[model samples]
Target: MATTTGEARAGTAQPASLQLPGIVLGVGLGGFVDGILLHQLLQWHHMLTSTNQDHIGVKYYNPKTVSGLEMNTVWDGIFHTVCWIAVLLGLAILYSRVTHSRRRVWTSRVLWGWVLVGWGLFNLVEGVLDHHILGIHHVYAGEGQVWWDIGFLVLGALLVAGGYLLQRSGRPFDPSAPTRREARRA
Candidate 1:
């Protein structure tokens, strides 16, 4: 008998722990995108991009100064390292969840939605703490950069909303249902 969505949920429903892997993956991947696009490709900003003006401890991020730029580059490297670790950890968790756990939530919509939520969360928290509160860096890192920072937050919010909606829409998904590939394997 083909399993209905209802039966799948009841028979092999994903527990709370199942969501962890997807969320972690999302956060890590999101960080990579930000670091690569903003830090490298766009060259719009860097870790501590505008910290010099804050007069904080050892301001070392003046783009005009070679030393300052070097300092910023070092910090950016550190940030990227952390992001890389997150991605690795997430992958480990996901692998364990899929291989060991009997109940797998493979619903594409649900997984992607949670991932989006995770990414949005990363953006919001990172933006608020690093950009606004800590005064470490801004998105544009120049005069009147608040607007750019705000825009980043706005984008994060939108991702969060979209992800949330997608997740809700997939509430009835049945991950236990065998796909054609699984049938072929069997």
Candidate 2:
């Protein structure tokens, strides 16, 4: 007897707690992508790309000059460290919460959806704070910079919406229950 989607939710763990770990993980991982892809790989911008005009009294660290490159590199390292900490914290939270077959949780759409939510949240927050409010850095930091920044926020919004829908369509994870494959086998 194959269990229906509704049956999967019967023994699910607390949804609130279940959603957290993935979100934290998503935030950290998303930061890594942004940092590695935009800042390092492409060399499009740096930590303090336009900070000189941010109205925060932050001096611009031009990525071209030796001293500027050093300062920017230091700030980038700090950003990466923060992302790493978030990932560690996420893992710790997941470990403490899941007592049974963590395999189920690992395969859960709900958790992954929450991760998407977290990533989207990161983009929205970062885009607003860094690109819009503080003017620390834009996505491209050149002509059509506003478009690039807006596009980032748009993508974030899409991720949040898409993830929410995907999770809603999924069955809840029941750790102790037989997996779908197992149920089908029997």
Each candidate: RMSD to true structure?
4.2, 3.9
**TM-scores, one per candidate:** 0.79, 0.85
Q: Give all candidates' CA lDDT scores.
A: 0.75, 0.80
* Best model number under lDDT: 2
TM-score (C-alpha) between model 2 and the true structure:
0.85
Residue 121 accuracy (lDDT) in model 1: 83
lDDT tens per residue, model 2, 30-136: 88888999999998777798887785778888878999999989998999999999899988998787755577787778788878888888888888898999898
Tens digit per residue, CA lDDT, model 1, 35-138: 99999899888887777755355465686689977888888899889888887987787666553313445545677787898788889988998888887788
Question: What lDDT is obtained when candidate 1 is compared to the true structure?
Answer: 0.75
Worst 10 residues of 1 by lDDT: 98-107
How far in Å is the alpha carbon of 112 misplaced in model 1? 1.0
